[model samples]
Target: MRANSKEQIIEAAGVVFERYGFKKTTMDDIAYAAGKGKSSLYYYFKNKEEVFEAVVAHEAEHLVNEINASINVSKPAVEKLRSYVNIRMKRFVQRGNLATALNDNFLATFSFIEKIRNNYRDIEIDMIGEIIKEGIEKNEFKPVDTNFIAEAILTCMIGFEVPLLTKSNATDESVEKINNVIDMFFYGICT
Candidate 1:
């Protein structure tokens, strides 16, 4: 199949998969959703799983690129980490389905989504570890378990998004709470 055809199917699949969800959606559903025939879908994707993976992978790549670009190596470690959190939350809003799938239902099962999530997460963690290394070099962030600290910060960022999708824009109070949590991550609450 042509590159454009494959991309169209993936784009269509993203909308259909999110609208109908991963389980209820079928190949015919995606084909019809794409305005193409079932054979065309099959020509591009072997199964529903392949289409879903393509959609998720596309979102993941987009997010990684956005976050990576926003990270400034020149900044202080904590400042870099702060920008990382803000950029990540913005992407969470933009990613829509993969974010919803990872944070919401998706047939109430997330092993497949979790695997995809970890693939993206590992990069963020690695980038954070690099910042930690930089901090250690400059005597900024304490020289502790960088990997564990990175994991903690990443978890906090994901936690911030967990409730926002369900609200009419989660309240200022909720945003305040999550920001407080994130701030504690960058700097200890006590001066």
Candidate 2:
């Protein structure tokens, strides 16, 4: 077995956790996956919880980086918001470990999971709020409470997670539904 780096351990642990979940997974499983001894795992992390936290943090950081990159384009605020929604939804599904960590009720047993989720939630709200503020300043969108609208959009996103994860073929139909919802958010229902 190679001398596994901490990142390697975390990456391996993510796979193990995704396969067996937080409770069912053990240090041995992570070690085997990382091609390291169980003792080597301890050198980097105190326990499975620490490893799992690292994995979640890694995934969350990756998601934030992608979101920031996608939204930093020269497009209008409306396009930035649309890009945010598309990337967030797409990545949320594609990143299995993060999705499992956030969506699985069982993982809620880890208290840190809630903290990580709350941190991500706050970041999401702030980013959306900025986009809304930009939209209002440019008169691309009507003046509204940015925080309220951001929170509302986040709530809708949270509502979409479970159903999207459950469906066997969710991508196309889900994207259409999400776009429809965005259009409704932009345009009034009275039409």
Candidate 3:
């Protein structure tokens, strides 16, 4: 089946952005990659930023879909939480470059980019909150403020991104760290 023009543009843009980094990628490069003229590209995306935004959104959607699938698999809340964190961290590590680029200070300055980032975060937190709520309902986890706990869990994951995504630490070590966190989350550090 033939891909639609916008899908084709977004796919080409992802390749260009991944290869060149956001700062160096140009609209012409994406247009060329997509085998479309500049005017045709403009018809779908007003600028490189717009194209990049679409690419980021596309990537975010993919991540969310994966997380949702993982969550849907039969498991208790504790197991779901562990699976969620493991899957999320693993995916982030796989997309380390893109994740780092999105978190860059310069990119943070763009309102559109910031909005996209915020939207992705909110969706993730909501998903996590659902898992926590389920755990509580099932009596597998102690009752807590779902929103607060979800946000906190996500914050901790974000904090680990530097080392986890950068490969500053070994992948097994990072996974161990996540497991440790999940353990502490389910059972307090107190002896």
Candidate 4:
């Protein structure tokens, strides 16, 4: 079926792209990985760029789903926020393709990346804003601008990612640092 073949190609392409990265990967590479001829790839995707975009979108969607699944709605807002950050950071380090997509150099080279980044930001903002709103409604958190706080938390997380990416491995120290920062966010330093 056309749908199955297309999904097969995207799935294969994700592996190739993860291995070779976008700049080094070619149509032949993806086609070979997919166990199809190069022409078959052309039928489904206009070019390598389109294929790469699909791969990035696919991986991102997977991560978002994982994050959403890990959040327990019955839990307190603080725990929900903590769980979201822990799972997000842990997975970001674990998923090679995702790390590549978020890499600054990869982002700078692809025009399509801007749209993906913006879409991701919108999703994060909405998710975090909802949690913050819920916290306020339950009197767990002080009243504040939910959108602004959510945006700030998103910004902080992005800042955290840079340090994690630089290291050859994500050390426990790094994760501990993240936990400490999150703790600071939830409970101020003065106390």
Per TM-score, the best of the predicted structures is 3
Colliding pairs, model 1: none
lDDT of 1 by residue, 10-122 (tens): 99899988787788899998998788999998887888877888898887777777767767546777676666666667666554666866675543374666677678679
What TM-score would each prediction reach against the true structure?
Answer: 0.83, 0.92, 0.93, 0.92
Q: Tell me the lDDT of model 2 at 16.
A: 90
- lDDT by residue for model 2 (31-111), tens: 999888999889878988889888988888888899899998888997898899888888766747788778878778889
Query: Which portions of model 3 show Cα errors greater than 4 Å?
Result: 1-3, 96-98
The residue-by-residue lDDT of candidate 4 on 30-135, one tens digit each, is 9999999999999978999889888878888887888788674588888888888887777666656666777657566788877777888899898888888888
Q: How would you order the candidates by lDDT, starting with the best?
A: 2, 3, 4, 1
RMSD (Å) per prediction: 2.6, 2.3, 1.9, 1.6
C-alpha local distance difference test of each model: 0.75, 0.85, 0.82, 0.81
How good is model 4 by TM-score? 0.92
Greater TM-score among 3 and 4 belongs to 3
Regions more than 4 Å wrong, model 2: 1-4
Shift of residue 27 alpha carbon in model 3, Å: 0.4
Q: Residues 50-141, candidate 3: write the lDDT tens digits.
A: 88888988888887788788889888888888888888888787763347445777778778877887888899899999999998898988
Tell me the lDDT of model 4 at 144. Answer: 85
